[model samples]
Target: MTVPLVFAAVFMWAMWDPTETLEDLPVALVNNDIAAGTGADRLAAGDEVAQTLLDSGALKFDAVDSDTAKAGLAAGDYYFVVSIPSNFSTTLSGIGGKTTAPALISITYNDNNTLLASSIGDSVMTAIRAEVVKGTAGSSVKTVVAGLDELSSGIREAATGSGQLHDGTSELSAGASELAKGLQNELVPGTAEAADGGRQLADGTGQLASGLTDLRAGTDELGAGATELADGIESIVGGVDAKGIAAQLAALKRALPNDPSLRGVVDELTGVVDGLAQLSSGSREIANQLTDPNADYRSGVNELVAGSIELNDGANELSTGLGQLNTGAQEAATGAAQLADGANQLDAGAGELSAGLSDGARQAPELGDDVAQQSLADLLATPVDTKASNVAAAQFNGPGAAPLLLILLTALVPLIVFMCCKPLRASASQPRRMSLRTWLRRVAFVGGVSLLASAACTAIVWVALSPSPDPAELGKTLLMVAAATLMHTAVIAVMFAIGGYVVGAVTALAGIMLQMFTFGGVWMIETVPGLLKWLNPIMPMTYVREGFISSFNGSPGFWSALVIVVGIGVVATGVHLLLVRERAPHDEPLAAGSQPA
Candidate 1:
């Protein structure tokens, strides 16, 4: 009984409160860090760290002179001395290195004084270092987040620009597409047709050219003939004058009338002479028409030659224009193809950029939420920040006391009952224990008594600590305490039934030790060693501790805890009744005896 009480007291004293040891621990802090640069680039990391530590209230930090801190460590007056180097802010802020060098921190410890205390001091320094890094990173994250915000703004602007570009390109593509279609369907074909017509015209002009050359040769022949006719007519006219022609005709007529036979001959001769004169006059008129200078065959031939030359020139120009048109048509088709392809590529690129920007806009709200409280420079410099939050917080100084007390009561209650109570017997005279039913009834009575005691303790802790202000949470606390107590009574009573009083007391001590290692009442179960974590699910106190935290914090997991605690009691009772082999022989009375090792 005394042993169980002592064990409970020691366990409670060691881990009843959270963070108290860390808060009260004496440590010396010295800040010698200073900014190396001027303006906004300047930063004092040591002073910032000191301010954060003070704000968080995570440590019992003392600002002391460097020499005094060093003396204190040597004299065992302080756990350790923490001195911030002169280059602390300069190195961390990278004002000197421009991000080429990493920040460095130095801690001095007197391990000879107390190794555990020194280790703890080192841990505290590590935590301070972490806090400093967090603050610095938050500043940097604020800068980066701001830059991201600006980038997002820029992307949105770019998206707007891209949309306008898309519209312009779409119209361009449409025009290019139509141009390509026209080249393929109309202009190129029409140009080919015009080229064909030009070829036909060229051929016709060549034939006309040949015809003109023939006509020119023919005109030369006609001129030569006309000149010969004119010369012949002139010669004939010169020989036959009008007066001589008339006298000749008269003589012929006079001769014809004189001679009868001669008359016939004379008449024929006159007719012949008259015919010759008429032919000569006609020849002169023909010569005059052919040789006239103002409007004659020669001038007409010259005009014809000029017209043929003009026609030939015009045919050549048409052929040349058609050739250029054909070439231009092909070039236009090629250009349209290139334009369409370029427009398509531009449209695709713009669309992708726009889509990516839209997605980034969609995600901006979440990112903005993360860096809402930070600044632009900090976000840019340090883009990531790490933080921690507890879902089920103790929130009070003595919230852990309930779980710690519950664990104690679980062991100590049974120890006290067994030490104080009398054993069940069939009768006073016989002094032998009754059947297993008698044992169970006595265990039930002890459980009832333990429940009342546990409830009372729970109420006391609730009123004093007010771990949870809610009425529902207080009710849950009472439930957990009662369940834990009943289970403790069942398990310890079962141990006594199976192995007597010593085993019961030893079982209680063992249970407390298991609870100490496996229970998450003080340190989180996740932070414990692997083996202890492995045993965490198996320990009944694990559930009780979890239940207490949940109840106080208004979280879940109470039902699960209640189920496990009740199951433990039921199983323990069953094991006690069925599995225990008492030391007494068969058909003999049950009596107290030592358990097997």
Candidate 2:
């Protein structure tokens, strides 16, 4: 009884509430991360994470340098070491920059120290990663919110500017329309009238040139006539001898009579001769003035004729240019009309653009308030929070494992009993055969003692561990233990009866190991090897362990597993009765009451 209890005590004590002792497990935390950004944007992610782990009390985390952490982990002073690199914060802060890389948190574990230590480190790292992600995401979102606020402001200003632009464009379009209309209606028609006037002026200038040419010819004839008349008069004056004739008239007047009337008639004849001389002199002066190169009349007439000819040529050129100008004006009128239409279209487009900008400004989100923006950022960063619940939660590891230990201890009782004792008390040399009823009674007595011993071992472990406080669960577990004890006892009895004590002991120990391996004790059934898996369903320990576990967990498999365990015990006992038969009369020893060689 003490032997089974001693083994159970050692196993239970080792596995009892392992998680509760996690704080005693030494783990090194090495923080090498440099702060990222400056001033308001500064973040010390490694320090923050290290502090959180320390404060959480999840594991005993010792803050140490990298060398210390490594030495401690190697020397088994620490179960695991968590190291945050120098670029941790910097890499996290680079999320929105031109280049980005994942922030690495390294965890090193020594499986030699403890196999489960690595799994614990993995869990701790996962939690730390989540926290880092939340913090970094929140910061990134805040930056995005700030940018959006600035964007909204810029859009509002643009909307106002666009509105002003629309107004300006409206005035510009109106002015352009007026200019186009003036060009088309007033300027174009006025240019055409001016061209017509230019053509008429050219015709008038041509006429004036022709008239001047005729006047020039007439002036030439007049100059020639004047010269001829002057020459004839000068000759007449020379030939007539006007002065001598005047003297002769005066003499004749004196010879005729000294009377006043005779003298007056001679004087009148003299006056006529003198007047003819004066006319010849005036004609010579007029001819000289008309024909002289230095005279104004001849020069003026020549200049006038040359000027008219040049004027007429200029007028002809002006008329041709005016005709071209008129054609150009007509084209300009059509172009101006098109320009006015284009300006109107431009104004319409500007109005639409202004309205679009205004609508955009109105629709833009208002993220200006810092308080509201931060709150929004935080909400967006961590959208979902998880709350976990376990329906069949175990308080400690000891209570959940008590059933497996009880089953193991109970199985040990029958093996130890059968190792020293025989299955049947009758001697092999006996000639008379023992009745089945007597044989069963002898076996029942031994089985009863083994069952009592098994019950005591199981009860001791159950009470010490207090696997379940409920009387119903304890009762069910004890019933399964009784069935397991009987099954092991029958099975081991058959082996010892057939193969003697040494073989029976070896086979019993081997069966125990095999049962443990296949019955979800050392490893789960699914993970066990294929040969073991095939033997798992038939193993008596399988139902016994399952029944005990089901009873503790308050589940449905207890009754079914209990029935199976009882059935296997019945079969093993039947096989033991059939296989280990009493020796026959001839098969007995040669001498009665003597042992067989």
Candidate 3:
């Protein structure tokens, strides 16, 4: 009895605070990792992971060289060993650079240890991996955030430059528009007016040339009339000389009768001769003046003809020049208008582009601030957190597994007692009969004692724990425990009753061992191997644990466990009844039979 109690106590205690003792686990740490470079590249990921482990008190780090760690693991001195490669930090630092190989940390654990110990080591390694990833990713993210800030600054500068360009183009466009207005409103009209004046001047010059030509012809006719007048005067002078005026007058007075009429005629003739001579002299002077090249009339006429020809040529040249000037002015005006349009278009396009750049610059500060505040690693971090929550919290350090403990104790104690006190068999003597009632009564007594044991153990545990459980939960716990105890004792009794002492004890022990492994009373069944998980549903202890936890914590699976445990007991009892028979070849039924005959 004492041996069974001790066994159950120790087994339950071992799994009670499995996670709490992890800090005491022996792990050999070999930090061979080095920094990537000096100064800025001095990020060491492995060192950071090791420091975090030390700071958080997550593990008992036994710092040692690689050789010592490896030897210790081989000799079973250490449960597991962690080794960081020399290029670990370097590879991590070059993540986005040219490096392609993924950084790795090697975990060497002893396979000779128990499966539970190895599983614990695996969990620790997973934590270390998380720490390394967080540190490395955080460092790389800071650099990317810095680069974003610089890009934003460059965008702002570009916007400023574009704005200046727009201002300059706007001024150019205004100037060109003004020039076009001048051409249309002032210069074009002024040029047309000047051209009209040139046309008028040309007409005036044409009139002057014609008037001068008429003056030249009138001078030629005046000179010809003067010459004819001179010829007439000379003829008059010749006739006076032929008449010998004074002598002729004297002869005529002697030969005449001296009449008063004849005398008057002679006197008038004398006066006429004198006047003819004077007129002849005057006519000769006029002819000389008219024919002379130096005279005013001939010289004036020659100068007028030469001047008129010059004026005609000059007027034609002036008219031609004015026509060309008008054409040139029109071409210049058209060109100015085209230039103004082009400049205005250039200014408008530049202004719009500059506005877009300014808007971008305005937004750049907010974007940079947002990017600078957040680290890329924080956004992209992948963290693993393992939580071991107890649905039915343990009352004491080692009594949380009370349900499993009670089951094991009930089965073992009964089987051991059955083997030690071997009951006698019935003889084939006078009137032997099977007594099912007596067998049931004996099984009931053992079940009652098993219930008492389970209740007493739970009470003791409850008193020992800090902040004792509520009364409601305690009452439920007792009821679930009592049911488990009855089922366990009944099953064991049936096995012993059907299959004698040795066979029954061996079968009970084997079943208890399988239940310990399959029942998920310690670690989660999912984390265990597939074989153990597969056996979980079939094990009776699995239901016992589930029922106890459900009762205490208000979890599910209590009904299922109760039904399965009751079914198992009934099946065992039925099997015992069928197997039990009169194997002694009795001739008569026995009156009182404690065992099968």
State which candidate has the highest lDDT.
2
Q: Which residue pairs come into collision in candidate 2?
A: none
lDDT of each: 0.61, 0.68, 0.63
- True lDDT of residue 459, candidate 3: 73
Instruction: Estimate, for each residue in 519-590, the C-alpha lDDT of model 1 and write its tens digit.
Output: 655443433455566877888777776566556545556788788888997887666555432332223333
Better of 1 and 2 by lDDT: 2
Cα RMSD of all models vs. native, in order, equals 15.5, 16.3, 15.5
Candidate 3 has which clashing residue pairs, if any?
A: 431-589, 431-590, 432-589, 432-590, 433-590, 582-597, 583-597
lDDT of model 3, residue 462 = 60
For model 3, the run of ten residues with the poorest summed lDDT: 383-392
Model 1: residue 109 alpha-carbon error in angstroms: 33
Model 1, C-alpha of 183: deviation from truth (Å): 5.1
lDDT of 3 by residue, 9-62 (tens): 544543454566567667788889888878875787778766766665567778
Give each model a TM-score.
Answer: 0.47, 0.39, 0.38
Model 1, runs deviating above 4 Å? 1-186, 222-242, 247-295, 306-310, 340-413, 416-420, 423-597
Specify the poorest-scoring 10-residue window by lDDT in model 2.
385-394
